[model samples]
Target: MTDIPEELALATLACRAGQYQTSELEQSEALFLSSSFCFESAAQAAARFSGDEEGNVYSRFTNPTVRGFEQRLAAMEGGERAIGTSSGMSAILSLVMATLVSGDEIVASRSVFGTTVNLFKNVLSKFGIVTTLVDMTNLDAWERAMTSRTRMLFLETPSNPLTDVADLQALADLAHQHGAQLVVDNCFCTPVLQRPLEFGADVVVHSATKYLDGQGRCLGGALVGSSALMEERLVPFLRSAGPTMSPFNAWVFLKGLETLQIRMERHSRSATVVARWLDEHPAVRRVYYPGLESHPQYALARAQQSDFGGIVSFDVADRAAAWRIVDNLRLFSITANLGDAKSIVTHPATTTHGRLSAEDRESMNVGEGLLRLSVGLEDPNDLLCDIEQAIG
Candidate 1:
C-alpha cells in the first residue's frame, strides 16, 4: 500500500481540501436542513436505509452540512473519517459508549478538563467502567497504572487552566504496548498547533467550540480516526444515541476552520506576551504557559506543539488576588470558555474545575490562585495594561 501524504502544508490543505461541488456551481457551501431526502421509490429508500444506496437517510445520521465539516476536519487532521457531536463532552461520551465495554478500564491524565474527569469517573462508572487518573507528566505512573483491563489512554496536552504538557508520542507508544488506544483531546492546541495522529495516537478528539471555531459562536465537537473506527464503532453509536452536530453549527465551524492557521498564530503571539509579562508581574506569582521557560515540561511542549497556544494561565497571591484580576479585566470575557477571537479570562478553581472534588482538585494542582487567560487577536500591549490595572 502506498503511504498517504499527511504532511501536506495545512495552508495548502485549508484552501483546497474537502470541496465537493455539484453542477449547481454554488460558490459557498450550502446547508441541508431537511429531515429526510427524497428517494425515487420505496425500494430506493430501503436501499439507503440498508446501506445499499450510499445516500443520506436522515439528518441525524447523515446530513450534507455535517458531512462537509467532517470531511474538512478529517482532511485537516490527516484522517480518513470524522464524526461531529453536539458538544465536546458528547464527543468523548460517544467514543466510550461506542468503543469500550462495561468491564474495560482507562488510564487517563488527571489534568484533562474537569467535566471530562467527571464523565469518566462519575458517568461511566454508572455503567461499570473504571478510570484511574494519574499525573500527566509522570511516565512511570502511567506504566504502573495500566492493567489487563486497560483499553484506552486519554489526555489533554497543555491541559486546561494549568498548561501541563503531556507527552503524546510516548503515551501512544505505551498504550499500543498495552493493547490499548490513545485518545488525545486536541481542544487546547488544535490541529493548527499539534496533530496527535502523526505522533502515533489512535484517535483525536476536538471541542470545536474552542479553537476550531476561533470564536465563541458555536458549540460542537468531533472525533477523527481511521475509517474502521468511525464507520464501524463511533458512527453506529451516533446513528442511534443521536449525539449529532447541527448543520448550521457545522457550517459555522467550517468558516472558523478557514482562518484557523492565522488565528492560532496570532493568538500564540499575543498569549506569549501575556504569559511572559504575567511571570514578571509583582502580584502574579506564576504564569503556567507552556511557552514559559519556567514551565516543568517546556522542552517537551516546544517539541510536541507547533505553537505554545493561546492560553496563558497564572497564579496570583491568593484566591482574592485571582478574583481581583478577573473582576477587573475590562477587555476579556470572564467566562469559563477559551479559544475565542475575543480575549477570555477565567478562574478555574471557582468556575471550570470547581466541579471536581477537593481531593480531585488538589490532585490536579488546580490552585485557588490559578487564572486562565486566552489571549485573542487583541493587541498585546492593550492586554498587558488590562491585566496590570486589574492587578493594581
Candidate 2:
C-alpha cells in the first residue's frame, strides 16, 4: 500500500512498484486467482457497474493481479497508464483496433518480426487497414512512405533475427509531423535496456511473453502511453473485445519484473562475448549484434539502449550449413522463443521468417544461411565451445 517514490531507482521500481498489499501485509505480491469479486452490498455492486466507484467487477478488465502488473510496467516504462492483453500479437492488434479506423494506414519497418508483418498485411488488411513497409534505418524511406491517411508508425528497434537498430527519436518526430502515433515494440530490449517513450514516442507496446516473463513461461502483452489515450481508447476496446491477460499470467510477469534488471545485465554481458566469438569464427559469414563494434549501428545502440540485449544472429554459407550448426549445438536449445534462461538456437530462414516471401526475406537480409541465437545465462566459454564445435 506504499507509493513508489519519484526518486527510486529503476531496480527499486521493478521490485517494489505497484504493490497493493492486503491487510495481511504479504511481502511478495499476492496472486489473486479469483474470477470476480463480490460487492459488500447491492448498492456497491450497482455503483461498480455504473463506474461511480472503483472496484473489481470482472476478471476480464478489472483483475487486481493484472492491474498490478499494468501499474508496475507503466511505472518502469515512464508511461502514465498501461493495458494488459492476452498475447504480444494481440497487443499490436489492440493498438491498431483502438486507434485506427477503416482505411487508416500504417507505415512500418520492413525488418520487423515476420509474424508482425503478416498481422499488418494479412489480418488488418482484411479490415481495410493498410500497412506500408520500408527500411527501418532509412529516415528518408519512412518520410516517403507516409501518407495523409497514416495513423501509426510501427517498428521494432534492434529487430528480430537481424538486430537492426532504428533511429527512434527521428522516427517519432516524423510520425508526429505526419499526425501519426509512433508505436515501438520494446520486446527485445525491455525497459531495463531501452525505453522508447523517453525518445518522444507517443506509445510503447510490449510482448510481455518475452523478457517480461524472462523464462518462456507465460504469454501476455501490454500497451503503455499517456493516461488520456489509454483510458479513452485502449481500455474500452480491451474490455469489450476480451483479449485480456489472465490473472495468473499477470502474476508470473510481475515476478519476472523483479529480476529483470539483473537478468538483462547478465544477458547483455554474455551476448557481447558470444557475438565477439562468432565474429572471429571463420564459418560465421556475418554477425548481427548491437554490442559488437562491427555492427553498423553500434554507436546508435550505445546512445539509445543501456544494454545491447541477449539476441546474437549470424550468417553461414547456406541453409544446409545453418541447419548443421543448429542441429549440432549441445548447449543451446533449438527453439523460436528468445529471452529465456536456456539459450536458444534457431534457423530463422526456416522458422521465424519462413512465412515471408523469398524476396521479402532477401530485402531484409534474412539469408538462407542466417541463424538466430538467443543467448541466455549460460557460461560464455561453454557457449563459445558449443558453437565452435557445432560450426566444425
Candidate 2 lDDT by residue in tens digits, 76-165: 998999999999999999999999999999999999999999999999999999999999999999999988999999999999889999
In angstroms, the error of model 2 at 7 is: 2.7
lDDT of 1 at 233: 94
Tell me which residue pairs clash in candidate 1: none
RMSD, each candidate, Å? 2.3, 0.9
Compose the digit string of candidate 1's lDDT tens values, residues 1-392: 11235567887566446655556866677777787788999999889999988988888988888888898888898888899999999999999999999999999999999999999999999999999999989999999999999999999998987889988889999999999999999999888899999999999999999988887999999999999999999888999999999989988887889889999999999998888887887777778999989899999989989989999888877898888878889999888779998999888988898988989999988899988888999888998898888888
Strongest candidate by TM-score: 2
lDDT of 1: 0.89
- Model 1 lDDT at residue 183: 97
lDDT of every predicted structure (CA atoms) = 0.89, 0.92
Predicted structure 2: lDDT: 0.92
- Mark the 10 consecutive residues where model 1 has the least summed lDDT: 1-10
